[model samples]
Target: MTPMNPDADAVERAVARLTAALDEGRPVAPVRDLIGEHDLAAAYAVQRELTRRRLAGGAVVTGRKIGLTSPAVQRQLGVDQPDFGVLFADMDVSAEAEVPSWRLLQPKAEAEIAFVLKEDLADGDLDAARVRSAVDYAVAALEIVDSRIADWDIRLTDTVADNASSGLYVLAERRLGLDEFEPRETTMRMYADDVPVSEGAGSACLGDPLNALAWLARTALEFGDPLRAGQVVLSGALGPMVPAPPGTRIRAEISSLGEVTATFSEKSGKPEKRDA
Candidate 1:
């Protein structure tokens, strides 16, 4: 499932090649060997490649995304640890922004709470209170996750090598102060086109979403880039996964954080017909 290689440019080149292929909507294999050989870094290599190209194109990293933090998701990946990704300026969407559906590849919108840090927390006795104390606030968000890799057929190494399949993300406007609600006790309901798609609680996210933030801080430091003040951290998914279709609206209501919505613009195609 993995191969080791040692080319200094292997990771960067592999990322460029893969991003090019994906941008063209062409299929290609995961750059697992490139990651294994250049540096045994799967997640870091993925983000490095994404940012490498994104920066060349003049995009900036606005935040970070933590994936596979759920025990169930970890089990699915056959790994015990989670992975993370960088959030680009392109991924940020205000509450009412229209998200073009064609921009994503197999996108799944997730319901979760996002934390914006006021002070840097780089691994210490970082308790939930300290996590809360270093706060900006919380926002109800929808992460539009799309894998650049084909068929989403990937192993832990394969996915981690693809920026944790981090394609696009969108955020809502409303922000509640740290004292506004309990992060762990909050409950979330996901709606796709007004239908109840899934339901979950904040506890589902690594016991508490803040813990997810903590992990992101620690793990990203391990990956070479530590969390910095004013960095926005998406805690992870709290509800079930659903396919995001064109013209569909994704609404997520967190019991504590209020509701946030993301509208998906229909992909260009034939319009639906009216009944005769």
Candidate 2:
């Protein structure tokens, strides 16, 4: 699909708009107006430009994130493939720290499995075996997704250009080897303030979390930035995402992978207490 606006100019406009929203801590209109709703190529162009700007600003690439792994969401977006976003070092917030609410707009939380690579996927068939073998370990993680678009109103292109609506991520401490557990068979249940909020199985993520990794390795290779050794890969959500408003405590337990938690700080940066 051709962008509603032209190529380079449209990408520049999209980058500028998203950058402003991030810098000012406010959401803007959907960028689909500039880039077409279905022009994934144009959408990714905007993403690359934004990544470039972040790099110029001293940000370092930490890893990558796979989004739209749910088949239902993919069908809704009219795409057969999942989209990805670059993860930066600043996005990591371990469970020990409170996630500052001031750092996000329209934040939501989802449980996922995160893989740390032990080999480069730059040259290979990039099949399931290769990607799975490259994993050094897997851990439970919480992805705090946020949108730069106002009210979280976004289409495929809009979200893609906004770095797949990335915000902060919290990782659990336990590490399990592939032989220690089966990803597709794992079950996940997320809680907000000790109340169960969302639940699903590992199969929710592209049939298996490893499948998501394989797809990302192949796509990242095709895009000229293959998954490298030591990079962390968030293999998409294991369940439906739930809104994470300020002063909320989120905890996700994934069988075999253990649990991860994050408490969203109030605007004042004070940690919120869990419900009694």
Candidate 3:
């Protein structure tokens, strides 16, 4: 196994190579194979290094995204629970951004009811109502997920080190009061290219967004990083993800809340298939 402190130069090379592959359509080394029998700390440091470089290149840190909040998703990844990654400004589409289809490679979109926090929720007992009290607003969000792993074949650790397949997020222009919304009772439909794909109730996301948020609170605290006030939480994917094809429009509608959409960049499209 790799030691706690992996070679800094090696980590840098891995990050740079991965970033270059993403830009130039080159094949990337599978993360699992790259870190075989290695300590997680070493692998994680590579992720941080990659994050730093992306930031230096104009990626703005906007919010954080949590993944695997659904127990079903956790079981699929063979993990106990969820993980997180910082959201870059580039990942957000402010209700006005134009999306053409083509820039993303094998993308998938899922709807989520997001919680915009008002006050700090650290060390608090977070039931549904308590989570509601901490919320300042709610918006319908679409999470555009893309896996860096080759063929989407991954273990829980590979996912963690890959930053939870972090992708684009679209926030609806229409925002509603948290108290006015029942995320648990909420239902949403996922559509791709004007075709109805799948639908789900809030229960799909770890038994409602609030319970998902509560899990995040406790997990963060365990990691020595508690969630702070004003951090927008994407409770998790509301519906089963629908394949997002380029030149196609993707959207979602949350009950009583609103809708969000994502249009990929036409000219900047990626390859249609992968070796996954």
Better of 1 and 2 by TM-score: 2
Clashes of each: 1, 0, 5
TM-score of each: 0.86, 0.94, 0.82
In order, the Cα lDDT scores of the candidates are 0.74, 0.89, 0.70
In candidate 1 the C-alpha lDDT for residue 192 amounts to: 89
lDDT of 2 at 6: 43
**Once superposed on the true structure, which residue ranges of model 3 sit more than 4 Å away at CA?**
1-17, 25-27, 36-43, 56-58, 100-103, 122-130, 269-276
Order of candidate numbers by TM-score, starting with the best: 2, 1, 3
Q: What is the model-wide C-alpha lDDT for candidate 2? A: 0.89
lDDT of 3 by residue, 1-276 (tens): 122676666566656655655666544555655554334565566666666767777776655677887777777766666677667766676554565334354467788887878877677676666767888888999888776666666666556566667667888877888658778899999787778998989888878788888777665565555667877778888878877765668878889887887776654646442211
Q: With candidate 1 superimposed using the best TM-score fit, by how many Å does residue 5's alpha carbon deviate from the native?
A: 9.7
User: Which pairs clash in the backbone of model 2?
Assistant: none
lDDT of 1 at 228: 78
TM-score of 3: 0.82
